[model samples]
Target chain A: MASEIVVDKLVKRFGHATAVDAISFSVDQRETVGLLGPNGAGKTTTMRILAGLSPADGGTVQLAGLDARTQGREVRRLLGVVTQQDGLDVEISVRENLTVYGYLCGLSRQASATRADAVLTFFGLEGRANDEVDALSGGMKRRLAIARAWMTRPRIIILDEPSTGLDPHSRARVWENLAELKAGGVTVLMSTHYMEEAAVLCDRVAIMDRGRILALGPPRALIAEHAGRGAIEIRCDEAQRDAVRAALTAIAVPWREMGAVFSLPDEGADLGPVATLAGVQVHHRPAHLEDVFLRLTGKELVDD
Target chain B: MTEFRLRSVAGVVERHRVATVRTWKVALTWFLIEPAFVLVAMGSGVGQLVVEIPGHGPYSHFVTPGIIIGMVMFHALFDSAWGVFNRIQQGAFETQLTAPVTVTELAAGEALWGGIRGVISTLAIGGLAILLGWFPLSALPVTLLVSFVVGVQFGVVGLCSASASPSMSALTLVFTVMATPLFFFSGSFFPLEVLPDWVEPLAWIAPLTPGVHLARGLAEHSLDLSHALCALYLVAFTLLLFPVAARMLRARLVK
Candidate 1:
């Protein structure tokens, strides 16, 4: 596998604020990697640097081994960006918008027209070719933005929160399109705050927080390795809750306390004390990415 | 490489083309019909009051260049001001930034297209003036081209304003304090000879005043040294402005 994207200690500063701090990562060609981070965790900033939309305050960015600053156009030729905000022109018709973007990406008018039509069909927007973009739904506008990005046949596609604010149905459509891109061997690097999206769409994910990668691995492996097999909650009356926590923690057990409940990892731990009590209940389940996130990064992400 | 460059420009122009063509009615109305209405309304209604100064010719002739200047300024200013301002404020420029187009290419495409649009509008308005017996009728192409090029000058002024301005208030401040006054005092409406000598030097420094001077020569058929200087001033204005406007746009993009 060829390395398509390389960022070395990237940093971006906004006045007194350091948005991204010494972040380094790479995406291999044809790899669908996700950067999962909370809002304001610098995921969008990192993508902006890679897309050459924002300049890095420190370090270097190379796309397919070309310097982003020195040979930006060369690198841009290889990369397609699907921004979080939909940037489609409102007054223009759907088909006309794509054709213009196609022309900007080195296609002739006729070529752009043909490519625009094909893309319209590909995104299931064939019926909207002549309609104004403002007349389309939120989903259609997002699809158009995605289609416009891919009009140039880029070697790598970077999506910054592709499904940030879409409905479930619209999200499914975007996911389907992403699956098609993956099947066709297009390298993808996506940033998303949705744990389920990262777990489902990405081959591997880097869990980011506070401008650093806290954990990096495949979804199942990360969950299993960090959060264990599952969690069991022993919910008890107020008087019994402390006794439950004390019983669980007395054996050096890893546990969490929330009101009248004591949750512990179900990794073959001693549950003998729990069985002796009537209010104690053991519930086992498959671990999830959310659990892994909670265990490794703490619950502060939601707050941030 | 050249092909790619062309494509890059196409990309910027095309992104706006849908809106551009769809708003043809608006552009035509602003550039063509509205200007005609202003010319006809202002020319006929105001021409009756000219009291033609003996050597300066009919009141319409004097107002011809004034209307031409006003039309070009309106076209360019409107195009660059509202359109470019909206794109920047609404974050549409980000789309162009991600495309293969260079910032220079994008700015150039936009400014030139605006100039072209201004040319179209001003020509229609100029035709109305001619039909109303403004000038002798040989000043068509020179008047049109010179006035069209003026679009780039004023458009750059507006684009740079948008790029550097933190908000529309700042943009408005620039027009209020500087741009509007320059237009009024730039010898567009009245003869420079009428101005006091102290204010004369300051008015000469404004951009489009030279545009009026050059067009005046062509309209009157007297290609003298002042006319040549005015023509040269226009070329210089365009050359200096384009790169600076592009730089301002680039600065806005990364930040």
Candidate 2:
């Protein structure tokens, strides 16, 4: 399949500090790729450059085979962007917001209205279509924001933190909407801190930090590579923590400390030695994208 | 590309139209009722004291055109400055930029909206003036055209100021410093000749001076070389400041 989005060595700088430092990635047609990182990791900056909201100091971004820097209008025509902030027209009704945005996307009066209704229905906002945006809940506003993006019928959609700051129920609803879009073969590029959101929604995940992508691959593949099949979590006190660490190091297994617990990458290594240690509680769980992210960034993915 | 640019501008204007329509009650109060109050309190009340001005027949008639054009300036200024500033704070500019709307096109749309609003206020206030027998119905078309052009000029000026203003308080400060002087110094209430000679020449420096000159000439049915020059000045002013305003807003937003 052809690449719908290609970012090559994209660089953006604010004065002397580089926000996006020579990062490169691509998303194939109909693929969903998530940029997973902590705050100040350049994900939002990179996405803004792609969406034509900001200029890049270096590198090229191509969307749907058009150069983003030179052919910005064409690139924008092909891509819909949802910034981290809810940019919906709060004074208008949900349906009016979508309709007005459709007009902005160059839809005709009739076509804009038609597409607005369809998008509202698709995003499950048809019920409150006439209600003013300020009257809607935060989750409803978010859904409306995403629905506005679909008004253009864009081939590729770039969303910055698509489901951030939502209740679990609302987040799940947003995920369901996005999943439905992904199922329909739309290419999606998103930045998110939620490991589960990335693992569940993205076809491939890029772990980013300090303006660089440390690892990029399918979520499961990244977990298997960075964190073996599963990891052994040993909860121990101060003395036992050192002993557990020394035991894992003695066996040549890599380990990381998480407060009172020591996480040892279980490469089928002899866990019997660590488990036999006194005054320590041990538990083993399957590897996950969080482990991969923590191992790559060397820091916990705390909420921003 | 030009066609698409036009479409983008139309979209933005349409959004503004819908928003304005939604709050038309407030718009009516600003455009119609406020002008009437100003005319009653300032025009008729003040006109009663002044037996006659030299050239103009009545004090009310002398200030009628000034008031109409002043409304245009006021609408253009407030809409482009405060309205665009509010939209920027609300993130609507970012939202529009994400679409196919270019920065220049967005600026054009905003400036054009200011002009349209100016025309609306012109019609509102001018219509009331006609109903009260203070303005001529025959001059409505020319007054509307002049108001639209002046609107666009003030719009660009407002946009530039808005781009530089860092906060709402700062913007209000700028407005108080800038617009208040123009409001009084521009011959809106009295002729510039009435000021001290040194101050009279300085009053001509304000942009609204030419607007008042042209509007007074038009309203009094006394067209002359100065009115024609004022028209040219307004157009030139709009053309010169528009790109500057667009560039400033682009710098502020695209950063």
Worst 10 residues of 2 chain B by lDDT: B1-10
How many angstroms is residue B232 displaced in model 2 relative to the true structure, after the best TM-score fit? Answer: 1.5
Model-by-model lDDT, in order? 0.78, 0.87
Which digits, one per residue and each the tens of the lDDT, describe model 2 over residues A117-204?
A: 9999999989999998889988988899999998988899999999999999999999999999889889999999999999989999
DockQ of each: 0.56, 0.71
Residue B104 lDDT, candidate 2, scale 0-100: 87
Per-residue error at B82 for model 2, in Å? 1.4
Q: After superposition, how far is residue A268 of candidate 2 from its true place, in Å?
A: 8.6
Clashing pairs in 2: none
